[model samples]
Target: MTTASPAPELSLRDKPGFSDLQGVTVEHGLNTQDMVVNIGPQHPSTHGVLRLVTTINGEIVKDMEPVIGYLHRSKEKMAEGRSYFQYQPTIDRVEYLSSFYDHYVYVTAIEALADLKVPKRVEYIRMICMELNRITSHLLWFGTFLLDLGATSPFFYAFREREAIFKLFEDITGARMMYNYFRFGGVNADAPPGWLDDVRKVINELPFRFDEYEAIANKNPIVMDRCIGVGVTSYQDLLDYGVTGPSMRACGVAQDMRKTNPYSCYNEVEFDVPTATEGDVYARYKVRMAEMRESIRIVHQLLDNMPGGDSAELRKLEKEHAKVAEEIAAAKKRVTVAKKNEEAPNAADVAKMAEKAPELPFDYRTTGQKVNLMVFKPPAGEAFSMVESPRGMLGCYLVSDGTPKAYRVKWRGASFSNLTILPSMMIGNLYPDLMAIFGSLDIILPEVDR
Candidate 1:
């Protein structure tokens, strides 16, 4: 009747969302302890100032909550105060791993608001830079991930390629890490002298190196044991969680923004979207590795299909342009009669004239009709644009009031949403598998916390 005096309740004081008895389990007829542990706001495995508040019983994780916002830089609010051009430099820090994608979404949003036309050469250049960037981002992820898995060789090999690519970036962008190169309708400058040759050289050598990387890790027993059959998430489950990028691809969805949404010059390129059906850590790893190879393929096509012409044709066009400039200078010398009244022209006629204007040759990049950034503003409107960033669908939403400052600006970093699935994937899994599971997601914290 006393029920053996009823055992006293044992629980931690004021733990959030979980009770001690809820996660605790008995093994071999002995009671086990349920402990609450904080993985990090500073640990290496957390990868950029993320804290995982995890609850575990024995070796199995019961529940986990991600704590972010440690690296918040007030990016959107700052956009409201800075002019469009003035904000270019700041975008680099938004997602330092793939800053070009950030610049593309933001610049394209403004271009849409203003109905600006981007030159074919500019688009091709942007696409090449972006694809190269995708490779670099994936390379970094590749190295760090293997390091997380206790393999150090891939990190060095990965950085070797990264350094070589960074050299190309520095020559063209004037900065290795923060490019700040994409303008609203063009890039900061044309590819520097012989820069295209350097690109071709690097790209030609990458395929072989990628094959070497694959040989090193693909069938290694340690890697397969740790990654395979772990962190399984179905395609349907991923959709419910709003996951995208390699995580979604690992679930065998083949969802890539470059293919489905086709931003920048992506519509012009042909490449495969790799996928896997297992939807586990190994599947995610395979998806990313294939993506790097696909990225190299995309870069090769971009170089081959680039819009530049033969050197002889470029010289002849340059001469003709100089002749036209001389004639214009002579005309300016004569006193020309000025017209009065400046009546509005017909929109139809203007459209017809625009249609008739001959396009400049490939070497002649569409540069300045010269809109200065300090005073630049788009018409009062809103625009949303997305791109296939390395992590996932990176997007930007901008609202302008026909003023130098944006009325509102919102960033859609993939890391923010991708991080949400962590706890769900971790629950009921072994605690030691935390690094393998979290590294597979490959979330960057700046984007998540920003």
Candidate 2:
């Protein structure tokens, strides 16, 4: 709980990799002029539709400015126009790769405002989904980052693992990407039968999968030559720019919200916050790789110690189970009599009768308390909920005027803040190093513009 001393004010000369270039001027002959080149409004390495306006003097970037908003969807404004339930689905677009983090912040904000007490099982479910999402986001970053550095096979390898986790997500949330699963008090539904066992199986295999990824790109010459010592940033720079998540941890900050703030079930889990002192592209890459392993460790703890069933909804369903089971047995006996009476029962008829059977409730409940989401309105107040997303600290500020729709909804995206330090990082570097620097930051544009 002790606070660290404030960072000292640093000059441009104090910046790593920029010190030698401070007083030195690039000498391009009269034949060569400072040329302005546009990297992209459409390019692969940008990670999205983003343009970097760069002034290069003979392959040396003299200046660079990120031109954003090409992918703007006015997500904050849409929250105002739509009801709380209506706006929940759109929350996925804020940060699609790790949308669970987005949903967690939004849902928790309302949960806090309304004073909803989430059950232990519900908290465990949210924690599992969010940690799995962290792995998938980092997997995509690992693959795409290596691809940016001129390696292709790792991209496919990364997706192979990512898709496996997504399949588990699909089994639970019924969607692969934009899973609007997390709700105000709980989740949309309970985990399907045998789903927890399936999750354990997939996560068990992930450590081996991570080893395969590291084997490919860890010591590769192309990766090292492009990433190491490139886009070097200091701790002061990270603090000044409001950089967070793995990018901030790379600068040796260890400022993860999960560890420091401890929302949801994060306080109960045991895991280390991965950090590196180099504060370069390679450092960021290394931090994210280590974080994925920590996420697996967190998942292992959550699954092993998950709370057993105490869902009120399940209790209610259990009360009606005996009657429903009796009715199903009577219906099956009628079907048996019909077969004896020389009436042919088709597969469709048998399936229709089978639908009446009572299903076994999930071992762990997905919901804590039930609320009619279509007309949910919290008391007049403001609450800011934050979570350690795959990228950085993702926060949602909600102001409720005792209405179903929020009075104000604002997002503090880590990408937007992380992207601010890019121009400063690229100013003294070579033109080709842009991909290495930007890719390492993992700037997803939808979250940036949202």
What is model 1's C-alpha RMSD?
A: 8.0
Q: Model 1, range 82-124, lDDT digits (tens) per residue?
A: 8988888999998999999999999899889988778787888
lDDT of 2 by residue, 353-394 (tens): 668567643434566667899998999999998988998888
By TM-score, the best candidate is: 1
Clashes by residue pair, model 2: none
lDDT of candidate 2? 0.86
Q: Per-residue lDDT for 201 in model 2? A: 96
Candidate 1 matches the true fold with a TM-score of: 0.87
TM-score for candidate 2, residues paired by index: 0.83
Q: RMSD for all candidates, in order, please.
A: 8.0, 11.7
